[model samples]
Target: MTLETEFRTRAFEDVRRALLERREIALLDVREEDPHARSHPLFAANLPLSKLELEVPLRLPRRSVPIVVLDDGEGLAQRAALRFTELGYTDVALLAGGVRGWAAAGGELFQDVNAPSKAFGELVESERHTPALDAQEVQALLASDANMVVFDARRFDEYQTMNIPGSISVPGAELVLRAQQLAPDPTTHIIVNCAGRTRSIIGTQSLINAGVPNPVTALRNGTIGWTLAGLELAHGSTRRFSPATDGAVRVAAAAAARAVADRAEVGRTTRDEARRWADEAVRTIYRFDVRTPHEYESSHVPGFRSAPGGQLVQETDMFAPVRGARVILADSDGVRANMTASWLAQMNVEVYVIDGLTPADFTEEGVAPPARNAVTPPASDEISPAELSALLQSPGTVVLDFTASANYVKQHIPGAWWTLRAQLADALPKLPPAQRYVVTCWTSALARFAAPELAELTGKPVQVLTGGTSAWLAAGLPLETGETQLASPRIDRYRRPYEGTDNAREAMNAYLEWEYGLVAQLSRDGTHGFHVI
Candidate 1:
């Protein structure tokens, strides 16, 4: 089915129909996160053109699967289509009107990242009536010596950022597996909180669905609601979940997770069966290790990428963009994978958990490599960090840092100008003309891959800084900071409304309001094959 051809355009109606009918489709947004966050279709996944080559094989495995590239009139769709062709993606097309056009065509646009998963979380709460306690109620519990434990169902780093006092970091997928160990007393009340809503709702429901003996409730609106209620947050909390669990507890957790998965109609597959599924050329299959990153790094099944169960459930669109793709989750512990698969099944995905695996079966250790490699810079164009530092001393040397905008602001070469490879052509016009053009990124991988394009666009001498800014820092070289001399707009990352303490009340309220209405929006879309099993 090598149907690769000149990229064509697709109207919103055509894309909508494909989605409603459950046809395999990857409606990709090829813009930066900031721009992508502002608005996109309900199911559109962000695979920015800057990282397309690096992430395409992982996210969109089936070359022949229907793909519709879109952008906000940044002239990016055509470039992305060309890159897809170069990368052997056979079935690629462009959205007829892009993001704005979708709105013009009456297609609903959603703000924020991970809208699909977030909306699914909302649907689960609506259908399951997942129990929840407001901030004030939880605050009172904290004030008193209540026999309750608040578990922050977010990444540990997030918990460390701002969390409810006395809350322990027990990420969503770990809730059922580690809850018993953390709160050995069955009567201890369990409260889960995330930055906003999705993880908290999912985490609390996970324990409830698993038939946990304790009362489980979500902190409604999570940390946002806590803040809105004039509550103080604990920062830099290093609380971690207790790892030790008795055999009886593990047995009960496995049975509970299995039961929940069975109720959700999640498929069970053996190692051989999952391998067969992955080998099938007709369908796209994403294999992931749903355990914690530390566990994954210690040992994981071969060919499985590390995507923490909680993040995977919250960011399905990012991990597996193909709406109707098959997903296989692996975990040595029966609890995490099954629990993650249950939610994915409810999200209308063909999800399966690999069963009957042991520690010895997971022979692979260390982080799994990326699915695809980008173009390599020629040796002739590679400049060592030492050489580049000396070049910076002379005039007419202009360095463009193509790292993420936030990273560029945090640190870069002293006189480096920040730019994006996706918008380098536009950014070049604003940058100073120079005898030599030096490009660098955080690790230099992106910059190296971008050398050819910059060389072609500029028709000038181009060189890539070896090891990028990281190498410069490693060399103990002086570096500059702040968002100075920016050649491009800082739109690489979206500032989530629920993060940090500086979010405006209006934005936080509006975000919660948006989530509140996701069920309705999902209904109007007439797609999202979601169910609350």
Candidate 2:
């Protein structure tokens, strides 16, 4: 039977009703990231078809959970449904007419990633009356030698890109744990900011919730507000919170975070409990290490992925795509995990923190590898960088790079066409016909995963560039810059207005204006199950 006949289909209103009823539905946009970012339903998670097999286990652990996949009428939803069936997904359906159908049905389409969380943050500010200071007020404070510190509650990379002149990089989850150390004086005021609203509001409230003695406030609408006010942002600043030397400070921070977690009713679990959760066949469980990347890289619990506490709170949907999944957070320092778990609980996740696990138990190094069965492309389908270089010298071989667009623009193999794995069906017919095709990305995982698909699509001999571009560079091969050979448009990644040193003022203003309208959109959509506590 055809895929359309094999799987059920859900209309936009059916999906909308499921969301409003708080049912466990994974409304997925099975398109490439760029297209998914351009427009989607508020709760629709972007689980690109290319990464479906690898991510589905983690993101949707319950095999029987209802899944409604959609694309912008690119024939992806049908293919995704078939793949879902193959992967043992018991309840799979396609969104009727895809994303266009949702729009046609009067569903509000939101741009950018994590719209639900961002909108929820805006709602929190409106409902909770989160305190704030406008850019001018913050600027005047910066001018004086005020006994206050501004914490940039964004990722370190984001903070380093652009920030308030004197702000230190303390991500949202870290605010509760590190705020006391950053501002020991009870009378000192604390200011928090992010590229936009969510992190700033969440971070400020986190500090307030933890009962930090210092008065806390979000820096209005964050760096966007600062820039809109014609204020300057410092670039490439490295001011981050220093490690606490005082044992007493660590103890106090942990106590404060625990108190907040208790109030939030976040549960405490043991390693034994985690093992049991992992074994449960009917439920989804996410194991995360809520510490700094460096710390997580140095030593982390086995089977626990690294998701720093602050970024976890800011991007919960990305981490735990399954809304009702159980998340167990781990941290060598108890404070970060508890603080992060508190927010996750408020966000309506069933979250827990692993307690009584020692550093010895966290003996694993670097990020945890994907599960063994996630990707194991056949050995015969792989070619080394040197082999690929030799093959490229021949005429009928086409190279398709599947790395992110930003990485592709930075550097790639000469004469390589950057393509999205999910868009290969649409992209292949436009490409020059070739007898042999090579697939690659930064690492070979995505390339390997796409090899069979590319081969099937073109009816040609396709091989993965073993170890990908990184391996090619290590092999001393020449590299090319810019968007050189393109079989596809650079729509695989969204260009964030707050990124880099240079961004158009108009885009920044428009982005802020869009964020401001999100609360109203939430009301209109009537699907987000967000509650401000």
Candidate 3:
């Protein structure tokens, strides 16, 4: 038997009562962006109908929580309610009469919720959001405070050309990642500004989303607003340097490198040491010539794989998770691989930069890495196609093709997985270990960087498809490009199993609420076995 459910019509006052009574409620305003930005309720979160599916879930406490959806006289609530039900969300209720109804009932509306209203109001009152600062206010603040930090969110190169005086340069994407680095004190109030409003809004919102505790408010209208107020914007072509490291960082790193090099009893490896590693074992001392996957396929070191440098560095754990594992990083320019090795060294991993000049004439110090030879392989070291074919046929083989997204789509080898060097850190945990791997790129340098990393992901016997796909074609081997094949069990995305620790904080939040009886408990009496420290 099915029970017919009655629809409940919720009023603005009734919703307010629910909030005051401490009932779970999400007051979502469904409106287009321009209207929402112009005027919205103080606490109302704008999850526009177009982007509601993506934004609502991110904002809500839970799917089951009561969600009051409303729109501005557009008669869109019913459609939104049905969409929510179709998307498998329960407990979504319609707000009667929309924003107009709430306004008729004398409900208060707010401009923005992502920003702290009191601070923003003060900024607006002071006209700090305008382009120009009044001479009096500027003098008073300057006299009262000398430590206030002002930041300009623009490209560094652009800042060098022209920027406001005493403003620091920080790119938009760099804000969240570098917030703490820029301001160590939580009490430090950050004033973010851009040449325009969009970047300021987005940049300020990013800080808020990243959970920055410091108070942040954007300058309204940005530098343009400042200019309208008759404020002077500075112009300069010279570079501006931030604070110095006091010789501590460089000095400490040098000391550490010297100590480690001494303890290993390995000075910069001589040509002999480098060659010895290459010839030591049939598969030991695997070399990767890091480059684009396409180049690697062309031809390379007989045993080298194509591993890109960026991916190799990002997925160091996936590439070579083993502690004290030996790895050689090779790149055409040799600078990229060597630079990557320097960073890996800081992590205490054993990685050497190899300038695989060629099969013959491996050079010593003072010799420029062989320039890319058009007749042979470009100055970069790479694996041979024949060796790559051999490695692929071997049981327990892992093959990687590190090429750009566009190139990989055009053509690639069968059973070869295209991996972006940047995403390696995030992608490796899910890879399989049943087989050894041969990584390839457009050149051997990248393979040198990426191959060992593939080995580290599975801790299995591995080798590089030296010389990349080129080596395979050179050896008259078959290639499967542009196949768009499904990822095999060996290289498909891997999902991490949920662990108790992963939800420890969430469990604790639930426990506290349950203890206080502020919010209903998910289960009775410590079934979750959660404790807070």
Candidate 4:
């Protein structure tokens, strides 16, 4: 039988039924982020074909979990299915006819990452009557200098990019733990905001859920709404949460956070219990250190990856792609993990906090284990910057840059084609015939991974740029800007309309409208097992 016949194919309706029935399934969109963002089913997780092997074991460790791979009629689904089988996944199938088939079956296609979670955030606002204040009201509050503080509940980088005039960066999961420090007065009015509605609503509700003394409200629709109202936003703001210097404050915050977790019925697990969960062959378990990146990098539990508690909850789908997997969160202080686990428990994740672990347990550290199928480049197949420069001067040498789209646009080797590593198979045949190929990325890590694949596919000697584009710059090589030669369309990264100041007002308005319509779409999709507690 052919490859298509070798794998079972599920229709969109079958997937829909599986979702509504709450069956254990992962409907993965196996395309790059850009195209996946342009359109996809509500619950479809974006698992780019390029990062499949690296992400699969961490995200979907249960080999027998029923997985349906999808693509946009690009023959990616079948290829991904084959890869899944090769990775020892026993129950992999293709989403028949890909995303096009889903649309044809009258399914709604969302246009962003983490659509389900965002949509669920909207539902929570609708159901729980989450309090919020629009731009004009918030702007007035800012002007009056009332007893209030604005907390931007987004990543620090995003907060730095743009924020309300006086807002301090307090990301989602940190809102409860740090709120008292930012606003100690019980009667103080607290305003939470994100780039858009999801984080703001979730952050505001997180405070309310924890029963903070302050009266909290989300800045309606976040910065998007603020911008649309013609309000000015400050850029390059460096304001962040101050450390709690007082022992009483830390003790009180921990007690309050733990109380919230207990009320939510969040489970607690020991390191031994976590290890047992990881050893289970039938279930997928994720171990994460829920602390700041700096703390995590300084020292952390061996085999545990760093995922700040706030971002983990905000982007849970990205962190834990598999729907039914068990997540074990670790934090040295214990409060952050418990608070984060409380939210995850409400979001229908089987979550636990690693309790009673000492500082030494965390200090006995190591880096995260490499992916099961991580590639090691052969030194024979690598070329130094000087060697690549000389080769570029010669004819019949083609360079393909596999860096992020944004980075590729910033600077690259003059004649290098910006290519998506995942689309190499489709892109190779379209490239001009060349005797040799040299692959490079921001660093040579991804380049090394792709070199062997390119060599096997083209039956040509492929060499990796020793240190990638960074090394080229270090060697004082002339760089070029803008897309030069392109072997593939730049569909590897999605440009967020809500991000940065360059987006059109129309796009921002449309993005808001899309978010507003998500609740209705969720009703139609009927697969998301979201329950607001």
**Which structure among the candidates has the greatest lDDT?**
1
- Could you tell me which residue pairs clash in candidate 1? none
In model 1, the worst 10-residue window by lDDT is: 371-380
Candidate 1 residue spans exceeding 4 A from truth:
1-6, 372-380, 500-503
Over all chains combined, what TM-score does candidate 3 have?
0.33
Compose the digit string of candidate 1's lDDT tens values, residues 322-403: 9878899999879999999999998888899998998778998999976643343445488989999898888988998988
* Shift in Å, residue 39, candidate 2: 2.5
Please give the TM-score that candidate 4 achieves against the real structure.
Answer: 0.92
What are the lDDT figures for the candidates, one per model? 0.88, 0.84, 0.48, 0.83
Tens-place lDDT per residue, model 2, 144-191, is: 988889999998998999999989999776777677777889999999
Q: How many clashing residue pairs appear in each of the predictions shown?
A: 0, 1, 71, 0
| lDDT of model 3, residue 375 | 18
The residue ranges of model 3 lying beyond 4 angstroms of the native Cα positions read 1-7, 112-149, 153-166, 170-225, 232-533
User: Per-residue CA lDDT of candidate 4, range 331-427, in tens?
Assistant: 8775688888877887777788888888788764445667553534445478899998998887899999988878998999989988887788878
Question: Regarding lDDT, does 1 or 3 come out ahead?
Answer: 1
Assess the local accuracy of residue 127 in candidate 3 as a C-alpha lDDT between 0 and 100.
31
In model 4, the number of clashes is 0
Clashing pairs in 2: 173-310
lDDT of 2: 0.84
